[model samples]
Target: MSVVAVLRLPLAVDLSGFVKLLQRMQVPHRVSEEAGEQVLWVPDEISEDVRSLYARFPAGDPDQQLELPASGRTSTRPGFVQQLKASPITALVLLSSLIVAAVTLLGENLETLRWLTFLEFRVVGDYIQFTPLGDSLAAGQWWRLVTPMLVHFGFLHIAMNGMWYWELGRRIEARQGGINLLGLTLLFSLVSNFAQYVFSGATLFGGLSGVLYGLLGHCWIYQLLAPNPAYHLPRGVLVMMLVWLLLCLSGLVSLIGFGEIANAAHVGGLLVGCFTGLLGGLFARRKMAL
Candidate 1:
């Protein structure tokens, strides 16, 4: 059978532990060195499986001594630089969110935050004065459509959203590609932001929670349609997010001091996400059948 290179790591990187996992899984592969890089080749058919494993444990895990058919146990996690290289788009989003959070002082600094908010606003002595939506849009401020995803409101808000995005964004990016992931993210943000603006009505609100739900829905439905092991999410993860969504919609989360919940954005993002996943999974299923 023909083989393809699934990974190309720097010369200094070690995959001894990953190799052991491959051996345990009985995946046929070969490792070679070329021009100071380590290249891993596997059968073309199982390339996705092998690459998914490598992305999970780039340096391999040493503590996983148990023999499993296919395990996601970590040996030595990849270094920070390696992670950045592995998922640059995810890293960029997180970094941009961090910068926006800092500059906006968690949405306290209205002057700096106004540019990223969905609507234009002014600081009027401890209060905000919002410009009409039509005015802002007509002024060629198109970036406002999606920049709201970057303007988080609090520490816990950004933290939770960032963590979720990191988990879900990288999974899609690893399987599809950076461009696909970026496009999905932008689409999610645009829809979610607009939904929030319509439902909440010109008030101050911003976070990645809606987009996180989008990613979650994408992976959740995509896996169901295509049944790819790489896209499989834990049952507990699915339950937790769904429960949280329900609670947010019921207003319990907001009533309990977690702040106002963007129920419309979350629901809108999830709806669009499921639709996209259906389309994508159907296409992939068809391609595989051919």
Candidate 2:
């Protein structure tokens, strides 16, 4: 676990391309600020290779071509932040979630909650009554279908979802483009929210867990079929999430005081995401062939 500095660069110079290169090469690394400069650290064993790569970085040779492992062509892609800015869909989804969570924290505010939730329901003594807000949808308040994805119930809920969304959504946006990520988010949210409503039987439930599961599923399947560095995920993460899903569905989470789990939403999101990933992966493979 000993990490050593492999390369040092001035702060003004962008390191995103270099970082992406390392990621593509499956090299473990960490970047830290030191002495008014950025230091790239890697395992001691890979330090020399990293140093050698830096010595002949593509920036130094305008005429030389940079060939990625799988592809023979060079890519003149911008850095990560610049790419994110160019495609703001992921940022929009993340910001919407944060804003919704903040507004929810203002108070119990039943009116606001009803507006944001996928479907409003009320308990009628022995039976649960459901209302699907037909008027709102007819009035072009179509945001209701997807708004539930942003309705985080607590601080931890929002924080976890935000982190996952930032990580997964950014990766998707960077590789597949903003529109693809936006479409996937919308599809996942719609399916998961509706599934939750159907299974939970007019109960109040809201969070991004379902969408996060969809992202996870998409990444997992895409990495499997496409085998790209951008979609890489640690095996442990996949195992942990799958185990947690099983635990939730098994009713163990509720017994353990984890509160109500949206098992159906998670299932629905994962299924839809897997389907999307399958289609996307096949298309990518065909495009590469072309």
Candidate 3:
């Protein structure tokens, strides 16, 4: 799309203004000189900002700035998610869950999958969540910590989380494995949720947010450690994450966006995710002797 800059007078500020704006926006724009027209393709976004800057011009041609992306072909989401969906991680998770469901349905005892477990609350001074039951060495009451990451809030929440999990989880799970993925999820959740309880002190926390932010953090830091802009990870996942963080932190989205966000959980998850990714990268580098 065309980014308009007010030239203040008899205007024609060549193409350099476009570059400055893109630098300001912190996104790269594709610039090309085609025919007689100078074209700049900013992401499908920042087109408005570019336009807003254009609108400031007076009634005359000033001259009219063109936003090529808005007028040209629209950009679409990266193909990475589609590629990832076809990967083994997605298939394995789906098949495993289905198999468990089928076995639960067909077993002699005939226990349903839903009966396996759910969050149970014990209201003492405040809220309490039942954690996953791991061996004593891992987490004594840890069962109380891990369950939230596995449990979804509702159908939409579950669906969205599942979509991201399947899409993102596959690449990361492939990189880290079931054990590491579970470990990150658990570690981030325990730290973030526990911190949330400490600060918010609301009690009875439940959700995948800690783990979600953990994944986001891992993706963010991973990109920096090994810039494989071409690999399985979408190049813009981290950028989109920053946008989400800005929206959440700004509270500009609270009215229309996801109503309830445990900010503490987000902060805690992000910190842990970045830390894990850094450690993971360091360990890998040492092993490879890089």
Candidate 4:
């Protein structure tokens, strides 16, 4: 196969992330060391795509590293450490949820959970009363807007949401980048949280369900518009999620003793996610066309 040098960089610069990305995507490439630099070589036919990928992930990203086993060889499947390194934002969110779970005793500790809620609350005997949203905002509790995402009502709640997030979050971070994932998460949280508050009259509800739906919606629409392997989900995943959403909206899930469902939040997040995916996918498609 005819080869062409895609990039030549000083050894001090790390392209391991980029190399790993290529390997994950199964892009054919080779790395060789010259006198004082590392060179990335690829077949002439796919050099442009490799260059495009490099442009997208210069320096291999901050959280990504090229890992070698004790035998001085690369592993086909990355371990937990490597996965965590590659998706720091995802890991951070999961860790935050876990900590919140412990601190609030799975939402049983209302006093501790008050700080993370969208609105401050007071416990009155057997009832919990929430202050007006305006009161919290006026008091400069800005973090309250996004912090609710960290709160979990139960172990099962956090565990299920955490699993979905770990699966979806890493995919977004690996492809769209961490900053992109962070921005999307924040946006989804703000929109979905506010939607729930508006629709449910400031009830206490918290979980990553809304954000998970947003991530799913984003992937579904983005895959359609841009057609990238990273956004390509399994055949029934989208259907299953939508059906679950419908079940929640129908109040069937709540009837089964699953507690109150934040149907509004899920819907809000999904709408916003689809909108973002449309915008992002269109831009990506245009860029690729060019």
The top-ranked prediction according to lDDT is 4
Model 1 agreement with the true structure over 228-266: per-residue lDDT tens digits: 765789999999999999999898998999888889999
* Predicted structure 1: lDDT: 0.85
What lDDT does the true structure give each of the candidates?
A: 0.85, 0.78, 0.54, 0.87
Per-residue CA lDDT of candidate 2, range 37-139, in tens? 9988887645545665675573433333554445455656667786568559888987888787677772256556777776665557866465766866776
TM-score of 3: 0.52
- Every candidate's CA RMSD: 8.1, 12.5, 16.2, 6.1
Please identify model 1 stretches exceeding 4 Å from their true place: 1-76
**Candidate 1 vs candidate 3, TM-score winner:** 1
RMSD of 1: 8.1
Residue 39, model 4: lDDT of 90
Ranking by TM-score: 4, 1, 2, 3
- Clash number for every model? 5, 0, 13, 0
Instruction: Kindly provide the TM-score of model 4 when superposed on the true structure, using C-alpha atoms.
Output: 0.80
lDDT of 4 by residue, 25-128 (tens): 66788999998999989876555456667886785645654443444456578889978988999999999999999999999998899999988999899888
Least accurate 10 contiguous residues by lDDT in model 3 = 106-115
What TM-score does each of the candidates earn? 0.77, 0.68, 0.52, 0.80
